[model samples]
Target: MFFKKEKDNFPAFLLTSLVIILGVHIFALLTSLYYILPWFDIAVHGMGGFWAASFIYYLLFYTYRGSVRMPCFIAFVVIVSGTALVGVLWEFFEFAMDIINIPFLGIGLSGKAVLVDTLLDLLMDIAGGSLAGMLLLWLKKNTL
Candidate 1:
């Protein structure tokens, strides 16, 4: 019972970790906005799959490690749901920015590709998040 408090404290760490994870999403926000000749544009698009994969791995760790005392089923659900929500939001943000005359650090905007590209964003977001999660497990093991 002594450690119960510590385990319940997972939310704090989870939120911090998620914030850092969300920072990557923030970068995605920048990338989506950089419509023309954007920065590292090719690598960004290609790495989408990898990032989604990490999200998967992150969930795996949350489940396996997090479930020790309390069932992590809900954590898993929350993580997945939250990631998906972010992915959808990215699309909306991109589409909205294009329409609202928002400037992307001087990069010209493009709106015609919003629908198709947003779908791509969703796909890559899933892939990248899932992969990142899995890789994190391996990373923790190696570091330890």
Candidate 2:
């Protein structure tokens, strides 16, 4: 009822993204700076989800702005495909940080925990991004 038009205004997406990014930053600070690492899969919960969300928002932004000229299939494929690959690279970065050593302490990069978490993180990312894209597309066709 609040939104008068079928299309969602930019504020809805922008504010949501700002909160998500800020929350993720706080969590990141807690984990790294404060050394408050948790047993729970923090990677998946942290910026990973936000990344996917932002990507989906990107798709929606482009679509709403009338930038998506290519076929829908091609556009979705490109977005999803790139996200899947990016997920893989992210895992590598996290793992790399732990594997190398700069001083007396060696980072804990090579382990099953990181590996599994990375895979799961990517899964969540793909699921989130794909869902967002599809949902926005559906909303564009149906209602806001």
Candidate 3:
């Protein structure tokens, strides 16, 4: 439902993936699966980073098409930076949710718990974003 044309398959796939991830996250929150399964949040953050990186990669490719070839390292850097920014913004949103005491979505974590959670989330984000960057580089090398 998100694609405008056949050539937009990658972006459509990314969007669909993101939607599914969000749905699963919401379901987990509503059902308290996050509490039952402590790793759920980490998994979601990793997938979110991957999806964000994919979207940024798509945009970069679209913007640079028919122009000078962009270095693989440059593309990787952009994708990583974009995904990291998304991760940080998401953490901020979570902080806001905690402040507002949104029960289903907020844990109201503080002290070492917040520190550890944020660190793990950021680590997962970097791992996922790095994977996306490597995939992009591989595709560029193998295709055309």
Candidate 4:
């Protein structure tokens, strides 16, 4: 019943939004749009990071009923690290899928391409996570 709980609505909503975004990406991949559209991967990765961070933000605050007086630096670190961990896990999943020859979502990259792609994805993830972290910190200071 966790999904039915009132306090879980916002996180559920955030996750739903992520599902929609992922659906779009999956569609693009299936249609080979990523091959035609160069920036598609970058856009999806950045948005993934943003949504992942936002979901973490909501999760953290929703679980804490006391005063939301954490230092800005600490909050930023928590958000960034959480988001980065998610991103890394995703990369690992992709690698594992490739090893298992899963045709659905693997990028199917070789040595240099795999390294470059992973690094760029991580960089974009960090960029989006940092933005979310800054916004959350600002909101906590001013509104929460």
Q: Against the hidden true structure, what lDDT does model 4 obtain?
A: 0.81
- Residue-level lDDT of model 1, residues 21-132, one tens digit each, is 5575467566673444444333453354444444453455455765433234443444445556667775676666666767652223346554455666666666655555
As a whole number from 0 to 100, the lDDT of residue 90 in candidate 4 is 89
lDDT-best of 1 and 2: 2
* lDDT, candidates in the order shown: 0.51, 0.55, 0.82, 0.81
The superposed Cα distance between candidate 4 and the true structure at residue 94, in angstroms, equals: 0.7
So what's the TM-score on candidate 3? Answer: 0.89
Tens-place lDDT per residue, model 3, 1-144, is 222442357767887898899899999989988889989989988988888888887777765663645788887988999989989988888888998998887766789999899889988897888898888668756655
Greater TM-score among 1 and 4 belongs to: 4
Over 1-144, each residue of candidate 4 has an lDDT whose tens digit, in order, gives 123353556667787888898898899889887778867888888888888888888767776763455777987899999999999998999899889988867888899989988988888888898898887667656653
Candidate 2 CA-lDDT value: 0.55
Q: What is the lDDT of residue 135 in candidate 4?
A: 78
- Best by the TM-score measure: 3
Question: Which of the numbered candidates is closest to the native, going by highest lDDT?
Answer: 3
Worst 10 residues of 1 by lDDT: 1-10
- Worst lDDT run of 10 residues, candidate 2, spans 101-110
Superposed by TM-score, candidate 4 places the C-alpha of residue 143 at a distance from the truth, in angstroms, of 1.6
Report residue 8 deviation for candidate 4 (angstroms). 8.1
